[model samples]
Structures are given as structure tokens and as C-alpha cells.
Target: MQIPRWPIATEREKELIDEVLASPHWGGFHEIVARFEAQFAAAHGCRFGISAANGTLTLELALLAAGIGPGDEVIVPAISFISTATAVSRVGAIPVFVDIEPYTFNMNPSRVQEAVSAKTRAVMPVHFGGPLVDMDRIADVAARRGLIVIEDAAHAHGSQWQGRPAGSFGLLSSFSFQNGKVMTAGEGGIVLTNDEALAAKMRSIANQGRRPDATHFHHFTLGTNFRITALQAAVLVAQLERLPAQIETRTANACKLLRLLEGVDGIRWQQVHPKINRNSWYLMLGRVEGGAGRDEFCRRLREAGVPCSPYYPHTLYQNPLYRSSPCRVTPCPNAEATIADAFWIPHNVLLGAGGLMEEVAEAVRRAILRG
Candidate 1:
């Protein structure tokens, strides 16, 4: 049997929704939403939470709240998902592309300092592939340089760095609740911040730039109608309850595969930085060693009753947008190198059984030896 990347919801998800349907609260502004916001904020150790339409809006609003808009340059890692750069561009800010570390897949913090200049307004470091960035180092640099730090935490839910939660490190953090994430709201996202004023600005900015019940129903700061349905919040609340168990299972499964794949030739393993305690193992990446290539490796794994890919073969900067952006993609040489090298595999707990991950790892070991 093929191992699915994300299985259908367990019974708990349905039961939670049934309870929501039976209740009076449904919209995001309702009491249940507040409950979720409070619980999430408490979990992340943040002072305020503003749930938005999705991860894209989460960062977009965050940019606006952090006072980033036209002509300002927001430094972004080229290896991350496009939304990272788009969020900056959405607010009319120019995205200054930066490189990423080959092993950690997080932004190269040292290089980030070099990228900053007079036009630089904010540094948005993405915790790519569920690895935590060295936030303290990044923050110190931001402080000295007079820049805001925003975290694209789409992959790092429940991840920790030196006893601090991933979302708590940056000036503001963006989270995704799309179907594939650790916690899925079907379609949800949020921006968490310790800064109360910034949080308030994000809230109003995300909701069409109007204060709730303001005398001027007028849309004030050139905003979009980015609001998640109450149903999304209700569904997310259910997922949030199961998150601890899910993360535990995912982490364990990732460790199991990591150990199993170790000492195997041709499987380039991703290394976590020492400071990261709880890694949100969203996807496990493997590079074909020696003569074996990513395409062939993924193909063999798929044939072995495992849905191995949906590969992110290269960095997002190699994409045409950045290639043609007049700024040039070659500037971030390391980011381009890291992105061109690997393919992603299913990190699903279920994939461990059915000899899936083991089989895939074994196949790569064999292919590299034979080829």
C-alpha cells in the first residue's frame, strides 16, 4: 500500500466540528476564535495574536504593520517559498534577495548583515523546511542596523530555539494553516507579535484597514479584505487540540527515518543547528549521492509503494520572477546552489511502515552503489 503524505482526518476532527456546528459561535471574531488566539498566543509566548486569511496574508499584513511599504527594501532568503518575497512586494516594498545555509536550509544570518543597506527596512528570515533560524543572532544584527525582523514561520509550528518558541523570536511571525501544515484550518493563517501596537495595526490592516465600528467605515490604509471564515477557525481549533500528539509523532517518525537513513550512501541528510530543540519536521529532504540523481531516486521511491515526491528541486530564486527581476538571481550564489540540489520526501509517520521510508532509503543506497 502506498503511504499517503497526509492522511484523511482521524475521528477527533469530525467530532470537534460537530460540536462547533451545534454552538452559537462561527465567525473568527467569536469567542471560540478568541479561545484559539489566546491558546495559540500562550503556546507561542506572545502578547497578541491576529488571525488572518492565510499564510500569505499573515506576512503581508505583518509587513504593513512593521511599517514596511513602498521603496523600502525587505531582505528575504531566496530559498524559501515565493510568498516570502511576494509578501514584501505586495506592500510595494522591494525584496532584497539573500542566500541560505546549505545544511540548515535557513537564511544565512551572516550574509544577511552584508545584504542590509540604507534601503533595507526589514529582515524577513524564513525557517525553511521546519528548521529554526538563529534568531538571537539575527535580532542583534537587526537591532544594531535599525531594522525590523519578521519570521516566515510557515514550517516551524511548535519548533523551539534555546527554550524559546519559533514564533516568539521575531518582531512578528507568520504562520500557515493550509491543509498540509502540522495544523490545518483548511485555509487559515495568523500573525503573532509581542508588540501590541503592531498587532493592532496588523488586525486593522488585514481587515480592510478600518477599525471595528469606527465612525468612518472608510477603508483607511489601502488594504485588502483578507479575513478567514469562522468555519476555518472552528476547524483549526480542532486541529490545534491534536497538535501536540501530531508533532510528537512527526518528530519521532523523522528521527526514526533519519537514523535509518544514516550511514547509507547517496542520501544527503539535512543537519539541524545545535540550538534548535524541537524541530517541526514538515518535510525531509534527501539529495542523491554520487552518480544517482534526484529524479531517478524519487522515481524508484514512488514505485516502492510510497508517494515520495512533490519535490522542491531548486531554490525559488531560480524561478523566472527573480531571474528577470533586473536585480539578478546570481547575486545569492549559495542560495541558488542549495536549491538546485535536492528533492523532498514524505515525512508522514505512516510512511515509516509498509517499509516505505526504509525502502526508499535502501533504494538510494543501492542505486548510488550500483550506478
Candidate 2:
């Protein structure tokens, strides 16, 4: 009835995919993959880029290359997708989950100081909903403390803050080209970094650590198979060329909804960074000021043919994974508070994105009035 979730690829995407299928070499590990890597490096203002199987593995590879391993602790936002912390854990390191900014949903840079210890190795911040996490502040903290900043930029593509690109601030940045992202290769991702050594190490880790120029199956480091296919690369190359228009359209639709939802009594869209001229707008967040029926409000909007929904209806710390994890024995007050109140509505990429959002906002207004 309404626009489906995201990235309803255009005819341009269709044509390009067809061409890719017709080609003999369509894997991400092929020569064209290098082209895409080079393009992504240039786009992110990085010296080198390396493609990996998916967003999670790309992040893990980056952490490994950065020399984050056993006995190390990487501080992460408690409000983000689990992948952020899981990547840290996969390399035998502990994930020190810190609370997020109530408004930004990005890691609180100030909190990292409290979380840091002798074993603290890095800070991994997520760019929640496409706005750059106060990266300059994060970078300053990391530099002063001699810790690496690994950006889980899976939500941010082409997002910038104060003229510096989102991908440039971290020692290493991982971007997802997952189906729902702004720039997707369906199931592929990349790690970007200005450091040449880190970049090469990432490359080797993604490809089983085969030493360069020696094809005798020589292994340099213990690594895994996290390389993407040629087909995925072809899809990404095509998708990259069409991103500008798609981003403009999604931004326009998000603003339209923001205008309709603001001042609607209890509900409010999440705050944007003052430096953000553009909210790449991965999702449109709305927090209920004091509604007795926040969850039901969302349910009614969905039942009214609007298809809006809540994201992270409960906090991660409430889940079995974190509640029993050895890392945290105490409750994260900020994470619990934010997750209990914060929720999201859909931001579709279809031509009907604007109208769908307007209808959903109207539905929400009615539901709240009656709640």
C-alpha cells in the first residue's frame, strides 16, 4: 500500500545489473574490484581502500589490521546495531559498551574518557542515521589519548560534518553497501584509511593473508576469507554513479516529514548536528515526550496503513547477550533511558517517499491524540 522500506533501485540500476550478469568476470575480487576500491578511496579521501565480504567482517578486518586483539578493549556505543560490538569481540577483544548521546544516538565522546583504561585500544563510533558522529571531537580525544578511532560508518555514506567527510576522521572507517544502505553492493563493504600500512594489512586479512607477488600459497598472517564477489563489485560500481540523485531525493523526503512531525505535541524528530547541512537520514527518529502508550501509538499508525515502526523498542543491555556478558556487570543508565524512549519511523526511497511519510505523520498525530 505504502512505499516499501528502502532503495527501490531505478532502471539505471536494472540496466547495469544486466550488463554485469552478461560479463564473464563479475566477482568483487576481480580487476574491476580494484577500480571500485580506487574510486571509493578517492571518494572517502583515503589513500587506500579494501573490499570485504560484508560490513561486519570489514570492521573486524580493520580492527585486526589496527592491531586490536586479545586483552584489548574497544569502546562502542551501546545504542547501535550489535555488529559494532560483535566486530570488536570477533578478534578476541572485549567490547566496552558506553552510553550514547541522548539526542545524537552517536557515541558520547566525553564518556570515552571514563571508559578508557590501560587496556583500552580503540574507539569505534557509529554514525547513526547518516549524520557524522561528532568526529572532530572524537578524533581529538583519540589523538590525545593515543587511541585509534575506527569509525563504524555503516550508516553514513557521503555524509560530512563541517566540510570534512565522515570517512576521513577515523584511523580506519568501514562502510556497508548492504541492501538498505545509501550506497549498496547488496552484501558488500569496504574499509578506508589514510594509513598505507593499515590499508595493506586490511587487504591481506580479507584475502587469507596471501603474501603479495608470491603465488605459492604462502601465508603472511592468520586471516579469513572476507572477500566480496566480482558480481557485487559490478553492482556497486553502477550504484555509486547513481548515488547523488538518490541521496538528494531521500534527504528531500526526510525534510518534508520532519516539517510535518515537528511541534506535534509530544512527538519530536531526533536532533541533527549543527554542522550537518544534510541529514543523510538513514531513518527518521521520533521520541515521545510523555505518552502513556508510545508502543501502541506506533502500532496504530501501522494498522492505519502507514507502516511506521519502532526501532530498538528495548535496549541491548536488556537482551541476553549483554545482560549475561562478562564485560558489563552494571546497568548503562543512559542506554537504558534512551532505548526506552527512542523509536523510529520509516524513510523509504521510493518515488512515493514524501507522501508516505506525510500520511504516516498524520496517522501518528491521530494515534497520539486518541492515546
Candidate 3:
């Protein structure tokens, strides 16, 4: 089957790039950056947006803005991109690793409650692979424990839970515009918040602590430069225009593929809750069944022309860097089991025609049978 290419650049992208190239202000202060920030935030039902150089820096900035400093602890999922845990360390806070739901690949809310401690100040739940975490449960825990909620929405561009957008449920939410993300500008990120004061603080931190109206080289607080370029923002603006339609296409294709795989042995797809109104479908996650090794299954699927991968071979705590990092760990059986079985089909494949989904299902069956 022919799979569609990702980060599809059209005439609109070219037009936007040209505009940024011709403009005098190519820096972060450019109007184009502000426009992209506003537009992207509004799309996710956020009141304000602050653009940054990269996704990791955005999380650090959010931590800083929230006053999560040394000795503070932040609860995080055991299975996620390294940044989810490292971001807490970068801000001088320890990450408390919690188990995930085997099927959803998101942090188990019950585990979150167990991980909380006197030092716990916040919870950072990642909407892993475009499916929103259980925000309702996370919120209830946070409210009772007096902990803040910061969403790691890097994989959930247009996902929603119970009709609420992914970024809107948390006190602060971060999004990545990395090359592989559903939205891409090569490298960029943003933070969204409903609180005007928090938004100003984040902007200041990303702008080297300069006050919004400062005309001189004045620094109010300790901050660093995590600014995004006008060029990247221009590209993001163009990409944003394509997001809604792309999300719809991906979701439709995912549904078709899931239906085709129904009752099929040797495979189990992610179990999305009914409350999840829309899933971004960044990657269609599935687990190998019938005793096939995850890597072998992925190898055979690739040979059969299926764009698949065995993602996250191990939990984040197992990484060498985490060996010395100040993080609290607990046994996460679900996360460990998922690492042994998870496989992913990239979102670009879902951009293909509905018939291509049949080809994908067939490829899966072939890979399993061959194994």
C-alpha cells in the first residue's frame, strides 16, 4: 500500500515562509509568532499561548512559572518520552513515576494517588499517542491533594475528553511542534494557560526575564532565552490551517482500520474510552498477541510494506540517565508489559484512502500468521 508523506508542505507554507523571509522582524517578538500563538491556543480552547524554542524547554518554563522548584515532586507516567520525566529534573524537582493503563498507554489515575507525597506539588500526565489521559480522575486527585495539573500534550494536537480540549483541563499545558509530531515546524513548542498572570510569567521567562513593556536591557528575574523564531512560527501557522482536516482524515481511517481488525487474533488495539470525544491519532497503537515477540512482529510488518514500529522498548525509569537522577520509582507492571508488546503505525499512513486501511489490516494478519 502507498502511504502518504508527513509534514506535507503546500503553497500556503511556501507563501508564509516567503513572508517571514521578507520581513524585518525574524525574531521571537515578530507579529507572526504572536499570531501563531494566539491561533494555536484558541484552537485548543486556551486563553493565552507562549511559544518556545522546543518542547522540552516549554515544560521547563511551565514548571518555572508554576513555582515548582527544588525538593518539590511531580507525578509522571512511567512510560513516556524522556522529556516528560527529565523536564521535572531540569526544574530541580523529582519525578514520581506511576504506572500506566496497559490498553490506553496513559497514566493510571489510581497509581497517581498512590504516588502522591508531602513533597508532591504537581502531576504531569501525558496524553500518550494522541489519546487524552483521564482528566476527570486527574482533576479529582489534584483538587483533593492540592496539587497542580500540567498536561504534556505533545502527542495530542486535536484530542479531547468529554467534549473538553486536551490542553484546557490542566492548569498549564505544553505542545510540541517537532518533526514527528502531528503539527510540525521542525522544532518548536508552546504553553497554554487560562491565567493571565501565569501566561505573562512564562513569556517573561522565555524572553530572558524582560518585562512585556521594557524598552531597555532590564531583567526582573532569573530567566533564559527559549524563544521560537518567526520562521518556525510562520511554518506552524501554515501547518495549523491543515490540522483540522488532517485530524478528521486520520480519525476516520483509524476507525475503518479498527473495524477491519475486529475479532482478528494476534493483535489488540488501544482501548479508547467513550468519553474521549476525539483522538488526534498521532500513532495507532497496538500490542502483539498470540505469543509473537513485539520486535519480530514489527520486522515482519515492515517487510510486508506496513509502516510500523516497536515503540518504547523499555520504561523511562530504565534509561541510563535516570540511574542517577533524583526520581522516586515504584514497580509499574502495566508499563513494563506494554514495553514488551507495543507497536505503532505512524499517523501519515492513516492519511491514505480508506482502502489502504484494509491493506494495513491484511499486513498485520500476515505478519502474525508468519510469526
lDDT of each: 0.75, 0.76, 0.91
Q: Is candidate 1 or candidate 3 better by TM-score?
A: 3
Q: Tally clashes: model 2.
A: 7
Worst 10 residues of 3 by lDDT: 286-295
Error of 2 at 124 (Å): 0.6
Q: Which portions of model 3 show Cα errors greater than 4 Å? A: none
lDDT of 3: 0.91
lDDT (10s digit) by residue, model 2, range 150-235:
99999877777886777788889999988878777678889999998787787777778876776838888877788787777777
Better TM-score candidate (2, 3): 3
For each candidate, C-alpha RMSD in Å?
2.6, 2.2, 1.1
For 1-371, candidate 1 gives per-residue lDDT tens digits of 54665645767667766766777866555666767777887888898888887899899888888888887888888777789987887788888877877767778888888888898889888887777888878988899999888999998888898878988988899999887787787778889999988877877777678876675477776666777766677677777777777777767767766777678666677778888888778777655544236667666666655555634555666666766553323267656555445666655643355565576556555544544
Better of 1 and 3 by lDDT: 3
Candidate 1 residues lying further than 4 Å off, grouped into runs, are 1-8, 23-25, 212-223, 310-314, 323-330, 349-360, 367-369
